[model samples]
Target: MDFLHSGLAAIQRHLAFVAVDPIDWKFYVQAFSWTVTLFESYLLLRQYPLYSKTSPPESLARHIGQEDFEKSQKYGKDKAQFALFSKLFSQCIDSAMLQYGFYAWCWKAAGSILGKFGYGGDYEILQSIVFSFTMYLLSSLPTLPLSVYSTFVLEERHGFNKVTPGLFISDLLKGWLIAFVLGAPFLAAFLYIFQWAGDRFVPWLMGFMISFQFIMVILYPTVIQPLFNKLTPLSDGELRSRVEGLAGKLHFPLKHLYEIDGSKRSSHSNAYFFGLPWSKHIVIFDTLMQQSKPEEVEAVLAHELGHWYYLHPTKMMAISQIHIFSILALFPAFLHAPPLLRSFDFPKAVAARPPTIVAFLLFQMILTPMEAFISIGMNAVSRHFEWEADRFACELQDRLKEESMTDMGDRLGRALITLHVKNLSTVWVDWLYSAYHHSHPTLTERLKALESFQAKRAKKE
Candidate 1:
C-alpha cells in the first residue's frame, strides 16, 4: 500500500510538471497536434473492428465474390495496421520536435549558419530560403523511408505497387527539383511581401495566393503533369467519338482529350477535367481506359462533365479561398504573440518579432483542430457534389445513348466494383470515418441514389 501510494504520488508530480512547465501557446500546439494525432489513430483503430465484423451487405455481395470480400478485409486490416504505425511514428517525431524546441533550434542555427556565409540580414530572403530548404530536407528524410516501405513492401505484397526503385528515385528527385524551382521563387516573394508591405501585406498576400492557385489549376495538366508522365492525344476510337459527341451535346468547351500514362505508377484508375476555361482538357488515365468498357468510360466522363455544369470545382475553390482568408486574417494575432515564440524557446528579442516561417509553422500546428473540423464540412460538401455528378451522368447517358436509367446504373455499379477489386479497396467503411474523410460516396450509397433516381423516372414514365 505504501509503495502504491508513493508510485501514484510520483506520477502526479510528473503530470503537474508537464502541465505547468510551458505556460505558452507552444504547449497548446504540442497538446493539440498530439491529441489530433491520437484521435485519428483512435478513429482508424475503431473502424477496423467495426469493418472486420461487418459482413458484406446483400447488394454488395451480389457484385463482389466471397474470396474478393475476404481479400478486401485482409487488405483493410493490413493497411489500417500500417497506418496506425505510420501515424504513431509521425506523432513521435513531430511531438519530439515541438516539445524539445528542435524546430526552433534549427531555425536559429540555420540563420546563424547562413550569416557566416553572408546570407544573414533582418529576414534575409537567402536565409529564409536556405532555412526552408533545410527544414524540408530534414523532415522529408525521416518520412521517406516509411513511404518507400509502404510502396515497395506493403503495397508490393498486396500487388498494387508498380513503382520500380529507379522510377521511385527518379520521381523523388524530380519532385524535389520541382519544389525547389517553383517553391523558392513563390516563398521568396511571399517573405518579401511580408517584409516590405507592412500592414497591407495580408490582403496582398491573399490576392497573390488566390492568383497562384488559379494559375496552377490552369497549368497543372499541361505544364506540370507532362514533366513526370507521358501524355498523348486519346486514340481515335468509338469511345473518343462518343466523348466528343457528348461534350458537344453538353456544350462543354472540350478542346482535346489526353490519355495519361498512369499505369507506370499504379494500377489505380481515374479521370478528371482540368485547366482554364478556354484550355479545358479531359485527362483519362490509361489504366482506366484499359480496364473499363466504352460505356463505363463514357459514364465516368459524363460524371466529370457534371462537375463543370454544377460549378462544383469553382465552389470548392471559393471555399478554399475563404478558409485561407480566415487563417490569414488571424495571422497578425498569432505573429505578434510573444508567449507563442517563447514557448518554442525563442529569446526575448526574437519573440518580439517571430520570423514568418516560424509563424506559419506554428499557425499550422495550432490550427490542426480547426482544420479537422473544416475538412469534415468540406468533405460533406464534396460528397454531395459527387452524388449530383453521378445523377447527372445517369441522366445524360439515358438521354444520349438511349439507355434506360437502370442500364446506366448497372454500368456505373459494375465499374465501381471493378475499381474496388483492381485497387483491392474495402467495399464499405465506418459511417463516421467515411463522412469525415471520403469525398465520394460508397458503392452501395451511390447505387442506391442511382436506383432511387431510376424509380422516380419510371414513375414519371
Candidate 2:
C-alpha cells in the first residue's frame, strides 16, 4: 500500500510541475507531430494482420494434398478478402489525415501567440483554452465518414455489410453529441487544473488521465460496444457443444458464446474473448461462421482462448499504465526549463497564450524512439502469445484425431491465404521490418509452427 501511495504521490508532483511551466511552443509542436506520425505508422501496421503472404491459390492447392508444382498449378486462382483490406487501408489514410490536421492546427495556434510574448501572466491561460478546444475538435471530427465507409463501402462491397447509410450517419451524430456533452466537464477540469496548479500540476493531470483511461478500458467492451452492434447468444448446436467441451477440458470458465453481427458492417471475420468474471464472454463474428468450416472456426477460437489463458489484455493494460506514469513523472524536468519555454515566447497567466504548440511538437519528436521501443516490446509479447495459442489449438485438435487435426489446420491455412490474396499482401515480407511494426507473427511463421506441432504429435502417437 505504501508503495502504491508513494507512486501516486510522485505522479501528482510531476503533473503539478509540468502544468505550471510557461508554455514551450517548439517542444510542444515537436512532441505532438512525432507522436501523431508514430501512432499513424503503428495503426497502419495493424492492418497487416488481416493479410497473409501465401495466396489463396497456393493454399487451395496445398489443401488438396498437392505436393508437386504441376499439381498445385491446377488450383492457382486468386481469391481474396478485398473489401475488408480496402476498408482497412482507407481507414489508415483517414487516421493520418485527422492526426495531421489536429497537430498542424495546434502548432500554428500556439506558435502564433508565443511569438509575441514569453511565458507568464495572461497569455498562459489563453494558450490552455486554445489547446483544449483544438483537442476537442480533433477528437470529434472524422467520425461520420470513417464510420460510414467502414460499414457501407468496405463491408457492403464484400456482401458483409447490412447496416444502411442512414443508420451509420445517425450513429455518428449521436456519438459526437455524446462526446460534446460528456467531454465538456473533463475539458473544463483540465483547463482549471492547468491554471490552478501552474507548473506543479502536470503529474496530477497525467495521473488523472491514466486512471480515467484504465476505467474506460474496463468498461468499453461491456458498456460501449453493445451500443453499436447486436450481440446474441451462440445458438448453434454443434459449434457450441464442441467449444464448451474444449473450454471444460482446458479448465477455462467460459459461460456463453455470443455471435456478434459483424457482417452488419463488414465482411471480415473475427473472434475475441472480452470482459472479466461474470461479464466475460466469447464473441464470434457471424461472417466467420458463414465462411469457415467448424474445425477452422474451432482453431480460431482456440487462439482467442489462448489470449485469455495467458491474460494478454490485463498484462497489456498494466504495461500501458506503467508507461503513462513513468512519462508523467518526467514532466517536471521539462517544465523547469524556463529558457526553453522563453525561446518560444510562451506567455504567462490564464488569458495569455503561450507557444505550447511548438513545445508539444518538440516533446513528441524526442519521445518517438521511446514509443517505438515500447511498441516493439508489446508486439514481441503479442507474437509469443499467438504462438502459444497455436500450440493450444494443436493440442486440442490432437485430442480429437490426427487426421482431423491436420485437415483442420490445412483448411484454416487456406482460409487465411484466400483472405490475404484478396487483400493483395506480399507472400514474403521482410522479417526485420515486420518485427518493428507487425503485432502478430507472420502467417508463414504461424503455419510452419502449426505444421511442426502436428508432426511432433504424430511422432508421439
Candidate 3:
C-alpha cells in the first residue's frame, strides 16, 4: 500500500512539475489528457469483435470463446450490426476526443487571457470561475455534431432513429437557449462571490452551488423536461398500477409517473428517479416500456428507487463539495509562485487570474488519481446498492411466488446485453476498468448475483 501510494504521489508530482514549466505546460497537458482518453476509448472499442475487422472470424471466436459467443451472435451479421458498430465507434471517439479538446481549448484560452491580465488574490478566484463556466459552454458545442451523426446518420441507416432534422434542430436551439438563460446567471454569481469572498468564501459558495444543483434536480423532471419532450403519465394499464403499488409499499411518494418519448431519438432504453425528495418522480423511456416486460420494468424501477432510498445523490453532493473546497484551499500556494505566474504578464492587481487558472488546470491534471480513487469508492457503493435493490425485487417475488418475474430478470439481462453490445462496451471488463469507467457492475456480474441469491433462497426452502 505504501509503495502504491508513493508511486501515485510521484506521478502527481511529476505532472504538476511539468505543468508549472511554461515551455512544456500546454503540450504536456494536451498530450496527457488525450492519451488517457484515447487509451480508454481503445479499450472500450476493443470489446466489440465486429469493429476489429482485421481479426479473422475464427480468431474472434477463439478470443471471445464458446460460452459468451452466443451473446454476440444474437445481434447477427445484419446491416443493423454494421450500423450499430459504426455509430458506436464514431460516438465513442467523438466523446473521448471532444472532452479532451474542450479542456485543451480552455487551458489555452484562459492562459492567453491571464497572460495579458496578470495574477492576483481576488483576480485568481474570478479567473477560476470564468474558466470553469466558459469551458462548460465551449464543451457543449461538439455535442451538436455528435448528436447529428449518431441520430441522423448512423441510427437512421439502422432504422433506429425516429427524430427528423427539424426536431433535432429545435432540440438543439432549445437546449442552447436554456443553457444561456439559466447557466449564465449562476456562472456570474460564482465569479462575483469568489471575487468578493476570496478563498475563505469557497466552501460557502460551493455549498450554495450544490444546493442550487439539488433544486434543479428536483424541478427538472416536472418543470424543465416538459419544455422539450412530451412526458405523459405512464398509461400501460396493469403495469402502471403495479408500479404505483410497489412504490406505495416502499413508502416512496412518487407523483407523475412519466413516459418520455426517448424512442423518437434513439432505441436505447432507460428509467430514472429524478427531482428533489418532495417532488421526486419516476420517469421511464417509452422505448423501455415497449421492450421490457412488466416485471423487468419493476426490477429496473426498484434499482433506481434504491438510489433515492439510500440518499446516494445527497452523499455524492457532499463528496463533491469536499473536493471543491480542497482545491480552493490549495489555490494560494500555486498562485503565489512567481515563476509560474510571471509568464502570463498579469497586472499586479489582477495578476492572480492567469496563474490561478494555470494552477487550477494543473491541479486538475494531477488530481486524476484522486478522482479515480473516489470514483472507485463510489462505484463499489453503487454496486452494493444495486444488489440491495435486486434483493428487494426478489423479496417481492418470493411473497408472490412469481416464476414470471424470474423470466423478467433474464429478459432484462438480455436487453441490457444488446444495448451494451451496440454501445461497444467492454463485456469482459477487469476490476481496474470497472473501478474507473463503469459505475454499474457488468451484466454478467449482476446476473450472477441474482443467481446466487436464488440459490440461497432455494437452500432455505
- The candidate that achieves the highest TM-score relative to the unseen native structure: 1
Native-to-model Cα distance after best TM-score fit, residue 100 in candidate 3, in Å: 15
Candidate 2 accuracy as TM-score: 0.66
Model 1 C-alpha lDDT versus the unseen true structure: 0.79
- Residue 422 lDDT, candidate 2, scale 0-100: 36
TM-score per candidate: 0.91, 0.66, 0.71
- Root-mean-square deviation of every model: 9.2, 8.0, 7.6
Q: What digit string (tens of lDDT, one per residue) describes model 3 on residues 1-461?
A: 45633553454454464335554333444455556555555644444444334322442333344434443333323333444455455555544644455554565566567767775334444555556667766655655575677677666654567888998888878886777667666766765665576544555676778878876876676677888778988886877987897788677878779889887777767888776677668888887777766766777786677677777777777777777766655554454444343333334434334444555555576455456467768788777777776655555556556555554344445555544544334344455656666668876677677667767776887
Question: Which tens-of-lDDT digit does each residue in 1-461 have in candidate 2?
Answer: 45654775676665564545555545554455556555555554553443432333353445332232222222121112333344455555544544355444564565466656764324544555455556556654645465565566544554456667687777666676656554665556655675676655656677678666756657666666777888899995888876786677667778668899887766566788765544567888888788776666777777677777777777877777778766655554454444444434433331133333334434554466577678888889888878877776667666554454555555556655544433323444456557766788766677788788778877987
The local distance difference test score of model 2 is 0.59
CA shift of 162, model 3, Å: 2.2
- The 10 consecutive residues of candidate 2 with the worst lDDT sum are 71-80
Clashing pairs in 1: none
